[model samples]
Target: MEAFFYIVPSLMIAALLSGVWRLMRRSRRVARAWGGGRTAQARCLRSYTTTSGGGDTMVSTTLHHVYEFTTREGRAVRFEEANGPGTTLEGDLVTVHYAAGHPEEATATAPAPGRLLAESGCLLLFLGVAIAFCVLFMVTAHEMFAETDGLMP
Candidate 1:
């Protein structure tokens, strides 16, 4: 029983490590693309929103924006990303970065290594860690109180 309770924090540690790995990978990818890519003028095609988790939990909404740009070789490329120019409407001009031959590998804006949603796993990790700590503390206190109950009587 107590062992089961300790598992929560152990799982949290794993999750935290996973999050750190994801964040590092994400940062590296962004840095690689932006650091070694060419810049082009992109146009906003359309933006859409998705909603989830309605019952028993707060509704979550995510907005996705799509952009179309032409590479140096005149190849047309369209990419969808969760992060892009905010409040930029359709047909608006935006900046994009992409490799010389790989137009599909592109990003609208250069996200800072520490700020990229970096979100990719940080948010989930934080939630997991918080829940795990709560569970651990609760289980520990319960055991302490339970053990002392007999002495009090």
Candidate 2:
């Protein structure tokens, strides 16, 4: 149906916007954490996996790691983060950056300048291509429908 076509494009736009919003929030979080936080060596306390969506389709599993570190004032803090497999294992030592007041909010890796630029460029290109295709498809469909008299039952 023509209504269905328009709805699909609207959904795609909404989804794209949602993705961009999430990316921006994460970028802000990472930037703030890395820029003003103190760095420390953290020990990998444990690792675990969580699964979702099984049966008759693909099963998705995500690896999460917990790390513990002590502050200069001698307080111990532990936090968990989801990361790819083999990135961190039990007993591994990794460098982390965390705010002085909130040691629980820490990041394991800092984004490299080149890598950040490339990632942003890739996201921009993807958005442009996806929007172009959606516009082209909608235009073509509208024109085709305009040339027709009406829907044949």
Candidate 3:
């Protein structure tokens, strides 16, 4: 049906917006934590490979690293980071940035500029297309209703 065109794009736009909102909130949380967090030395306890999407097509894999550190108050904390597995090895020393209030939420690596730029570009492109499709849908609906009104006795 003609309505499919409008419904599909509308759903996609909603999904994209939701994803962007979540990412923004998470980034803000991490940024706030990093700004007020303390620094500590952590050791990479182990590394593992996670695989997804295989079979006859292409397979994707990511390496995850688990690190542990002791807080100033002598509390032990462990965090897993999938961003920089190749950069560290078991027993390797890593610098960790963590908020004192939430030591479990820590990161050993900063977000990559290239990846950030790529994501921004993709989001912008999708937003532009979605807006255009929405306008088209509205115009088509209006025209259809106007024609029907004229046809009725």
Which number leads on TM-score? 2
- A best-first ranking of the candidates according to their TM-score comes to 2, 3, 1
Worst 10 residues of 2 by lDDT: 144-153
| Model 1 weakest 10-residue run by lDDT | 111-120
Candidate 3 deviant stretches above 4 angstroms: 55-57, 110-153
Query: 56-144, model 2: which lDDT tens digit per residue?
Result: 88998888988899887898989887854476789999888877776777777664656665776788678778877887877877777
What global local distance difference test value does model 1 have? 0.73
The lDDT leader among the candidates is: 2
Task: Tell me the lDDT of model 3 at 132.
Answer: 73
Per-model C-alpha lDDT, please?
0.73, 0.77, 0.76
Global CA lDDT computed for model 2: 0.77
Each candidate structure's TM-score, on Cα atoms with residue i matched to residue i, is 0.63, 0.74, 0.71
- Candidate 3 lDDT trough over 10 residues, lowest sum: 28-37
